[model samples]
Target chain A: MSKVSFSEEASVEVVTESFADTPDPRLKHILTSLVEHLHAFVKDIEPTEAEWEQAIGFLTATGHLCDDTRQEFVLLSDVLGVSMLVDAINNRKSVAATDTTVLGPFHMVESPPRDLGANISLDGNGEPCVFAGQVRSSDGTPLAGARVDVWQANGAGYYDVQQPDVQPERNLRGLFETDERGRFWLRTVVPRYYPIPDDGPVGRLLTATKRHPNRPAHIHVIAEAPGHASLTTHVFVEGSPYLDSDTVFGVKESLIRPVTNVDDPARAEHYGIANPFRLIEFDIILDPVRP
Target chain B: MSKVSFSEEASVEVVTESFADTPDPRLKHILTSLVEHLHAFVKDIEPTEAEWEQAIGFLTATGHLCDDTRQEFVLLSDVLGVSMLVDAINNRKSVAATDTTVLGPFHMVESPPRDLGANISLDGNGEPCVFAGQVRSSDGTPLAGARVDVWQANGAGYYDVQQPDVQPERNLRGLFETDERGRFWLRTVVPRYYPIPDDGPVGRLLTATKRHPNRPAHIHVIAEAPGHASLTTHVFVEGSPYLDSDTVFGVKESLIRPVTNVDDPARAEHYGIANPFRLIEFDIILDPVRP
Candidate 1:
């Protein structure tokens, strides 16, 4: 045994050997690298004991602030832009196709499917509009029998899922399959701009950061065909107040379009609409994914 | 209203004009900056859709894996070095002062305090050693009555808290006060090197990064003197295998010291120790804090 002194190292062993066998060479390699990098970072910026403890405490609170209906952490991610980062990396759009945006935290497991040309608006108080759209490949080839899942906030920018008691079960939300020429149309009220859910830690974060939580008024669409990459994009009303500054950063330049007020009684009659009704037309172009 | 199109900035007005009110400037600024930078990062990487989804899933899992006893996210922060960065910004050490390190995930509240010269090693099985040290101001002035909280691993390098069921509470942990000459001495067992806890997301991250999780043997020490900056640092054992490559990068060359062995029977009688024993003597110098 070597002599033990409180002098600079030369005699005593500074580190101990491994206590247990670590299986999985891959895991071992990954863990070792992580430890080395992590350690290096910590050494670079030495923190006080109190500050370190405070950070731990903050993390503990963030964990406790999570539950079934309230995912403050997810909202945090959404605001932080990690959600979009992941979406962008996973769903790179073709040059000719519409760009994808964040799938906000409001999507639930199931939405009611409806027939094409059917009206999804339960309350008839907002601006009456007919939404007509086509699903096509990037090369303009129509995709027959494509499915479109669509949902949007009411005139007040609240969705059925958000105001379950106020809105009917399927209000402003429907799934429709395209016809032979990849055409899908529906009659509904135009969506309105509204604030995001603000009753949790995410709200506190917004308050702390001094950011508005309002998302632009837009229709959420998820279009899919068997061989093509599924498209989840949004169509913002060209005159929506929050377009330039969507709270969740879920807007694109290509998807913004005018809602025209048509006065021709004959055209209105063909679509079973009263004269001077509002109209919105959108086209979705998807790209085929490589197998 | 103007006949709005995708190119028209009119959409911005419509979206925000109808909302309750515009967000405060600070939040708006932070959110906008964050969005810009985050978007830039995404564009730079341009990861595939699947990879983006996987990144989202990783974040989701990171949030889910957090709880009272464990915070994988904080560990993530520690490993990422962000925690240290924040800490460093908050705690800038004065010149000649001991540097701080990561607080680690362990470190429960209220380590049972003990009187000066008390033995913290309860196991009684490891190689017996004496630890004697002094607390002084940077200019070598003794700091009498300074509080010193110390703890270390056992002969096998496991904290009592790590082996709760086997080791007695408060084993190898103690609190002491400096004497008039700023001197402190205690009898204890030599601590050994050990691995950090590796059963959480931090562990998974380590595995993914190919890094080892071993830490060199060291004693934790927190010294507090009136009107001076308190220090939370470690007295690293010299010659330890992991000293040069601490998993957390906590080892500083100035802090490493050898634990010497003594075999003088007469001297052992004077200190009431066995003929063959170990001795470790060191000093901790601290910088004064104005506040």
Candidate 2:
């Protein structure tokens, strides 16, 4: 006495059963759960034909906006909070490990390796600042020889990819290797808080929902030390707007750091920067490799 | 105090609350429920970064495949049974009224008006048959002057739109007014079951799930009479393949009708067809308009 007939009551079972013969069990589980939740959503919303059509149109427009440079679906997912959730789910960390945020869509090109004292503000877009960071193990031991990959927007809040014709090649992007003291230092411009690319359908979605399209100013960091877990996170400026309400929900309290006025002439000279320059110092803690 | 954080536990509330100031209450409600369900699905699946990217890629591909001629998203919805569920939810019928089904994506063009008893098989590609039907109210009273719009795939299982160059415009499609006796008749070929347009992402999904893309043979009908609720449904061919397992879940026991031989030469003369021809007879019942 099997119920093969598809009815509203039997919808979840019927669809899930259709995927029962899937060769990949993980895919099967994912799809089965997807259908279950999707049906629940449809039944709960009970959208009319017009509303359904509107949704389809919205998705199609979102899709049409995607290309090599702009990935609207990822932006859609980012705005919906799914992207951050996926980041959190994938990068579960130990108590002392740096909190991982979304890798974001801008890290398409690899960061060119540079020396510790090299200046990354190639276009000289914003006020010069020193970014000094130390990578350490969760148990408070310094992690020497750690590779640090960093990328960020310029003072105008546009990644290099967004304005290739205007910005210098690989502006505000560099990969640095930490020293014996687990320290890495680089000179770059302060990244300004800017709106996400808001000309697309996802941008229109934000407008329609009364949501802003801005992410707080921050530097993207990816720290990978040998025999330690890799991390992808951001160090937010102390008083950036939208810090409390990141459009992508990537902000965390521990990740915010202040920009200090370091007036030491010797240290500034050693770093090849002017005295009284603005500096952002952050310490990154990484966990041991997961079993 | 309210929680403004965006942890996994606080994700649904945080995202939904962002839409709190939406001008439309229905939009707010739908978005809140959507966020809730979507987050639940993501948590349940706990997909990895690569898997999430794969999902984003899949949706993007599906959206990219949509155009004026082909709507891959609609096909995705059809294969998932959301289309059928939406139909059932929208068209709750009286006990005597015919059950409703998906309007389907093929009815993009209007059915050209034709005289009753006209032959609708423009290409004469399949075995000739006469389709005779009566339109009646749910109380069993014949409803004269009813409008009947009908469309179907050809014997080769292709709609005119799917083969625009080969088939005539409005082939296998007609809109007719019932006679004084509430009788409508037309000559057409028997529809054949066919796979849904399966070259796109949705089709690839079917292949991954080990499910066929075929829908059973059926003719789409939309019946409307003055002061009555218009209905869209189908009369399915009896014993058709995939009837019990329609890719779109559109089959119902009450909709099935068998093709039978009509040996009477007199009736054939009246229908302008050969004697002892095959015939399919169906009757439609409509409900009074809902308040």
Candidate 3:
């Protein structure tokens, strides 16, 4: 019975009052916040009717472009930095833990399980490199048997799903188990920086805003171990374009790993690769699960 | 070159800087404000990744529901009161002028022009009523030759478009010009308060919130004159269910007109209606166009 007519000054209150009977308290909270912020945005923008219509059209177009393979709304969220913000908010671990970034849209397929030193580049795409990482607890104790899931775009910046005919199935994807010393190493092509699938409404937004659509070159990782929190993040390749200006705003200063050329035959042989192998090494630390 | 890593504390600045190169200043201003407000909302909600995904899915479903005849997003806008706020901001006139409301979605077809006092209820749906109103300027001068466009839902709370097979085309819709004395009258059925298209995601949202989707019974109006700004509004039928709880927040106290049972034979004869008819009289005043 809390029926109150709408007014400009009481807009937020009125709209929020409509949601008073939500069964879920959390849903009520989120809807209330959304209405308040949404109304505030509309009031601040004071959009003309034409402008408002244009926005609805934009969103509808964005939705229309989304399907199983293409997620235009996710792209919209990514380009607007909401995806990264959500990542940041959800992965708020201690400083001792490795920093996190967005798990981009390319992880649609699970990485096939492979031996620790197996090469994942089925088609030998991009520049060959050794991607070796150590998983550990926040206390630096090696987390043996930790799961390391990896996926990335090929040299030309396209994932297997994006180029079904051109790229071999799971061209640059793998799942691995860390050894007793908590180390995992495998062969992969150095991911090249590329524009997100931007031929759609989100791309139009980037173009309209004079923004670039390219994300920095990066490797995707989702690590998990018993008694430790699961972490989904990326290891950025240093010096890649758009590292600082990733279209998805997924770059973390600590997550950027340098691609170093190692002359050590011992290191290369250990990874079962040729001498003087190009290497990108990163280590991950996961926070212990709280009680 | 405003490349900066995304962080919770710097999310707003980093995102706004990305749109700094937008050529259109208005777009830039709007995007800047939008990003600021949007990021603030995300931060406030601190949605889990799952919650964020749910929102994206909701929007995608809302988009998928949109077609030539269905605008689920507009319904979303209306239910959240954004439509009314936009109308309020755009139609900020002096109190002497008429209060404005949302132009509901049924005004798709052009209302056919009819002479004053014509019967718009071709189907004879609902309870027969006489609707009369005068178009005047803010200074109280009758505005002759004002083009008044009118449309409304029928008794069962459905428009002709919703029931094409049952109702005739252009049923209960009309366009008439104000006479020299600024008087206009029409024969129509009293509109019944009805639910919005509640079979979609927005309807589910209302159901989830325990909010009924019915709007107060009302007739849509768009009056335009030579030197006055055109207005899109509604004259709400008083005593109708949901008048105070119009789901779209389109109700204004001044815009509510009672459907009086007037027993004036002479007046009814002048209007060519029954002696004892249901008369809903509403007057509209437009604001002059700014120089």
Which candidate leads the pack in DockQ? Answer: 3
Which CAPRI tier for candidate 3? medium
lDDT of 3 by residue, A1-291 (tens): 246667788899999988989999999999999999999999999999999999999989988888999999999999888998999899889989999888878899988999999999998878999999899999999999999999999998889999999999988999999999999999998999999988999999899998989988999999999999999999999899888788888888888889999999888899999899899999999999998
**Candidate with more favorable, higher TM-score: 1 or 2:** 2
DockQ of each: 0.15, 0.63, 0.70
Model 1 per-residue lDDT tens digits across residues A214-235: 8778888899998998888788
Q: Rate the local accuracy (lDDT) of all candidates.
A: 0.68, 0.90, 0.91
Interface RMSD of 1: 9.8
Best by TM-score: 2
Model 3 chain A worst lDDT window (10 residues): A1-10
Predicted structure 1: lDDT: 0.68
After TM-score superposition, the amount by which residue A84's alpha carbon in candidate 1 deviates from its true location, in angstroms, is 4.0
Stretch of 10 with least lDDT, candidate 1 chain B: B3-12
List candidate 2 segments past 4 Å from native. A1-3, B1-3
TM-score of chain A of each: 0.82, 0.98, 0.97
B216-257: candidate 1 lDDT, tens digit per residue:
888888889998877777888887877755655566677778
Worst 10 residues of 1 chain A by lDDT: A10-19
TM-score of 3: 0.97
**Sorted by lDDT, highest first, which candidate order results?**
3, 2, 1
Full candidate order by TM-score, most accurate first: 2, 3, 1
Which stretches of model 3 miss by more than 4 angstroms?
A1-4, B1-3
- Residue B7 lDDT in candidate 2: 76
